[model samples]
Target: MTPRRGGAAGGRASRVRRAVILGVSVVLAAGALTASPASAYLPGPVDDPLRTAGVALAADAAADTGIAFGACPKDSGLAAPVQCGKVKVPVDYADPGGRRIDLLVSRLRATGPASGRQGALVFNPGGPGAPGLWFPAVGLKSAGPVTRKVWGTAARTYDLIGFDARGVGHSAPISCVRPENYIHAPSPDPRTANAAAQTRERAKARGIADGCGRRSASMLGHMTSADMARDLDVIRAALHETRLNYYGVSYGTYLGAVYATLFPRHVRRMVLDSVVNPDPQGVWYGANLSQDVAFEGRWADWRAWAARYDSVYGLGSTASRVQASFDLAMRKLAKKPAGGTVGPGELHAAAENAAYYDQRWVTFAHQLSRYLHGDDKPLVAAEAPDRSGAKAAENGDAVYLAVQCTDAAWPRDWGTWDRDNSRLALRHPFETWPNAWMNLPCATWPARAGEPVDVGAWSAELPPVLLTQSERDAATPYEGALELHRRLQGSRLVTEVGRGSHGLVSIWNACLVSRVDRYLTSGDVGDADARCAGHPVPVPSGTLGAKDANTGRYY
Candidate 1:
């Protein structure tokens, strides 16, 4: 396949960027490594020397490539027969051995005896930082019981591959911002009375952006989804797949999009969920605007649900009251941050978490109340996503920042950032500024930013692929789902109405799961625009109480 080039915009950027991989900082797996103009492929450390052994979990030989893999034995949280090892990839594809960095690979091969099933399903949870190294083991267990049974026969059919992208997990880490850099004080004003803080936040946001120029400055020039896409192909070549069948969520959708665009013919039974819009403009700032809007919807949803626990929260009898109390807490936080470190950014960080799922709402409300009235535990342990294993997400963040900055030029002029934040915050004060701060580093990235790859969506040469999406997803937003569908020629979009989170497949809704199963097992992607409408949303309150409700209520 010709390596498609990208340029200034994802369209124009497409002309300059080598079409090998895609990018993202979400779901299970995000970001693919690629080659650059400068030769910089450094090999990585080979941990736990690979030993050839036959085990139930790790495969000795890849199905398609016939590449031999030596199991690097290790263990993670889930006690599955665990195998850990390293895949030596180019640090800079241009220079294969300048500085080697081992990419941590893990696996939880198919359970049960093998019948002939399709090959391994590579699962990426996004987060660019999420620990995918451990997911293969967890996926086999968590795909629930049935996926296992199918995969068991399918194991004879396929194998499982989990990899940590550059600077993530077991890979050489790049910790740009230390935990000490984070502010964690409680808010005292309850009205955002600190004018000093707003200015400080802006300055810090700018500083963080500039810091990238110092620390990962050279890295900034090379980190792009396009680069990572190339790295995946090396892996595919190693795995020996004639084509790759991938499952990506949130940012992974972007990864999958770039891959399908670059190697359309190599795609087999792909799933892009809670899709990311492949638009380059959206890639820079427009995407965050969507995030602010998406999180706002989630915030509203959380507020409404808090009403049920009014007695426990004492925040309100209705969701509105709860929202007010939360807003008051933010105002208070703005005045005096938790431990004086966590600021408006931190407050909104927790708010964004509430937007993630219902299981987390009570904790968000309880913690917000504690911070408001006078407590620090809940506030300190706020809405942050748990990233315990291998510190994969942390490493991914380093790599994510490096590549995203290298891919494009963010507004380096502080005024532009200020102006943009001011405008977005006016409407989306919830997570707007924090989201801005999260991506601010892109502005002053040190590396000479390259062009973005024009994701070639209209690929008639590509085989039909399946795309799944949830209605109220905050990360990717439903609009992106439609836009992506518009790009892929032979693509089939299967909608799961009113769903949240990324990659809702195999989670539930037989209607949705079955489509994925049929599509993967048999190369049939039913008629255009197939849908599992009005899907029954999963409620935390259990099926019985859910059934008893007058019915407008959601868990």
Candidate 2:
């Protein structure tokens, strides 16, 4: 996703770009797995016996007139032995003749026996800014177990496809600031009474907004979700598929929902995990407020779990005491950042991940315990930004803001932001301020906002869509999943009872795994939504008092 930039705005542009991308990266980086390199290509139109007899098609379309699949560039880091290519799509679909942007696409052929080839399944890791080129590898490795059980083979039953969404990795990314400006700036501390620090945070937000406007003005207005949905259609056409089979998480779920609304007939077996609420009123801003409250609840849950394992973690024997210990650690880090870099804010970014995924709970507790014991090394390492001179040619951070800030009109009035955040902080303290400041750039963003797509309903006949969500998910709360199911007539919702993990299907929790697998493989779900028990809460690996895992009970 590398794009060469003119050297005119070198010094200031670099600084601004780094700061903007880093801020967006920290918050949006949840749920997505670490990236790995792979090569892949777009499927060409030429008819072959294998295509007609083997791969399943959701619908019939004209012969593919798409770019020929070709070898990936040498430095592509795509070592997975797949095909890769670039598809040129209109930068703004409204003005198709205006300009074009190249989207980097990749595909992994179905590795199952020829008799079992299902079709192409598109995978999105959900950041809106997250680069999905590594998804094929993620599916091959992490999802191998689940796919193996469902299809009777390990590689994959369908052609696993991944791409860098527009303005993301490998796409024509939007750049606002330099990578160096991604330092630990002070965010508004809900507990902080310091007016001066609050002013600085506001200034920081303003600077990022202005920097992006000045540096990436041309790319800003064109990065909305509507445009991204249009791009998906182009990819579908190029792949010669009449319909799309998708698995989207977090922000990706929003993208998936929008796609289904815009092109209902073009869907086949869509799976939306950690579903986003598609209510027009909450297109981008209100969801963050929902996240704040949800994260706080998950934080409370983590504390209680830690108290239950007091013999191993020694944080406390009760939830309140465990929370106090965490507060003490944050205070210590605030006085002096651990390792001179990991401050209270950085620690929040690192530890907050636990609120979204249960698997992170044990590891985060261990790190917090060690931090209390004077080893902030792990905390610092978890969020250290890339200082390496090799910055991304098209930073995902820039695009995240571009799409979100432009997706729907964000409140332009700073006073509105201040009042709303202040009010929300009283009840939702854990993430309210940090999350507010993270998105505050939208208040003064340079992009021209687009009309938000109406995703509430679709009149066309659509495939049976499967929606999944953990009951306590902080990122995309469970209510959003129910809302999406309601919007999409006949869609089935699967709830992970008492769980908070973000990405559900291909992970642990056999109950969730079985439901999603069945939906994808057979396209058959109950006439309504189903609820499944969560994976058992985990304790420190060697805890002697560990009860029967399925019970998830401390005794």
Model 2 TM: 0.83
Q: Candidate 1 — what's its lDDT?
A: 0.57
Candidate 2 residue 68 Cα shift, in angstroms, is 2.9
Q: What does candidate 1's lDDT look like per residue over 73-106, in tens digits?
A: 4444544455665655544544232234556666
**Residue 357 in candidate 1, Cα distance off native in Å:** 2.2
**How many pairs of residues collide in each model?**
82, 18
Candidate 2 C-alpha RMSD relative to the actual structure = 10.8
Candidate 1, residue 480: lDDT: 88
Cα misplacement distance, residue 455 of candidate 1 (Å): 1.3
Q: Among these predicted structures, which one has the highest TM-score?
A: 2
Total clashes for model 1: 82
lDDT for each of the candidates?
0.57, 0.69
